[model samples]
Target: MKALLVIASLVASIMMTYAASPSLEKLQEGEKIKVRYTSQGCFHSSNYLMDFSPNKVSIYEFLDKKNKNPTKIGELTLSDGDTAGLDKLFAFYGNGKEKIGCTTVDNISITVIDKDGNTKATYHYNDGSGQAHRLEGVITLGEIVHRLRP
Candidate 1:
């Protein structure tokens, strides 16, 4: 009986934690979504950005590791299917301020902005083991964006 009770309590606690976690906000029409990836190292560092807005998608490469002054590398007009796919993927990230930091050389961040230019939600996560594993979704998003690079 004690074991059963402990299991039940654990389950309840986990449920509560999930309930409190921020979920990805739904993307509205004309809303903009941006994903940024930065990689730093002792000798080399780089930053990449992907922007999704309405029916368009743009990718850029930053000249420096600090994510400043990006030069447009590619731009594509999203087809109906591409837009739908992007919306589905972004929705996977539930809305809220999700900031998970770890000691690592790679970082991924996502920002959603309303049509009025108001920030909706921002998520930043570093790539590492342990607690950093919780933000694997951000890493996955980064990989997707990388594949989109032209």
Candidate 2:
């Protein structure tokens, strides 16, 4: 079956696979900011990068490694209660870096930014690649990354 999704978003000047491009200076609760990422599952299913906003999240799956534009999966509007979770998630974040031990597990990299384009956190879910970098801590983020399931 043919599938399609439409999302209205302001693409940032920086083109990234998993990073939000929003100007956030005076960002208030319920305001429009975004968190973006690409989730890799353990089962090797179809994966995609998503843009998460206060009200909704949109998804696009890559067709191939060389593909630039992706196919839209769909959009999910968040409920009022979702903000609380997002709030907690952002709470664990800060501006800095960390060196985490390598672990062989499925993970996704997520980057969050403040209104001024200041990066609050950059979470890299590595499979023990021996590379070192860090930003924030989020355990339950698996739920958000679950959207990549297909």
Candidate 3:
């Protein structure tokens, strides 16, 4: 009976770990922000601007200052069933440099699709240390937008 109880406890612990989502900090108003993904064996980053009104959330990515790039990556949208309350989306924008003879960017988009091609979660990218750097912090869209506002 003791062995069975131990096995059940172990299973419960594993399930809790899997069910827990990444902890996110509450963003204030306006700020420039970045997000990095470090799970499994993949790494990516994304950058963007954030703004919020009383009832709406807006995320903007400056591709070249000519037009605003608007799209959600992965589970970065607050409307996509993300109880975590993320309000902005960012993508991996390369710093216009090459590393180790390979092209790399500092942004990424986390997109989830169903088997039938339906859209799922879209997450933003911040920054990933890649094979050398490790990011240690949580960024919020409100915080970034707050910093950029005049």
Candidate 4:
């Protein structure tokens, strides 16, 4: 009975992994993503680094102006569900149409790096307000990421 139970557990784990979307699978494979937002009118800025590996969710952030350094703030772990949710949040932008067609923001930068620390994708915005929805969503995501922090 113990052997059968172990086999069932393994099957279930495999099924769960296979059920993940391709993007989510990449996230789980140690892809590191970073998002940064700056308020040009003020000195306040927010930066976050997300790694979906073991206990790697809470989002390392740097919100200082003078320090120019990032301090570990949240200790949240990125669950599979959370990663899926993030997929939903950003999937709209990947529809083959550049959402930022000439639009801009105060200052925003998003970067994705592969497991080996190679750049996968990057988006940068400045001096406009086209990606407000995405930017706002990122801010909301940061809040959610912080909540899961230990």
Candidate 4 lDDT over 1-150, as tens digits, reads 999999999999887644432254356456666656444334334455554443355455656756367766656665666665556545533333444343223454567777788876665545343443454333334445447552
**Clash number for candidate 1:** 5
The residue ranges of model 4 lying beyond 4 angstroms of the native Cα positions read 1-22, 37-47, 93-108, 125-139, 145-150
For each candidate, give its TM-score against the true structure: 0.51, 0.44, 0.25, 0.51
Clashes of each: 5, 3, 29, 7
Our model 1 lands, by Cα RMSD against the true structure, at: 8.9
lDDT of each: 0.60, 0.47, 0.37, 0.53
Better-scoring candidate (lDDT), 2 or 4: 4
Q: Give the alpha carbon lDDT tens digit for every residue of 1-150 in model 1.
A: 999999999999876654342222345677887878776656656688878777666889887756589998777775565555544444343334353353446675777788999886676655432232244333343444455652
Better of 2 and 3 by lDDT: 2
Q: Is candidate 3 or candidate 4 better by lDDT?
A: 4
lDDT tens readout by residue for model 2, 1-150: 123222223233233423432322224444444443343444443445666655676777677887478777777766555545554444333212342444433344565655566666565543333231132332233454454452
Off by over 4 Å in 1: 1-25, 40-44, 77-105, 129-150
**Which residue runs does candidate 3 get wrong by more than 4 Å?**
25-34, 37-84, 87-150
How far out, in Å, is residue 108 in model 1?
1.6
How does model 1 fare in lDDT? 0.60
Determine which window of 10 residues in candidate 4 has minimal summed lDDT.
96-105
lDDT, model 3, position 5: 100
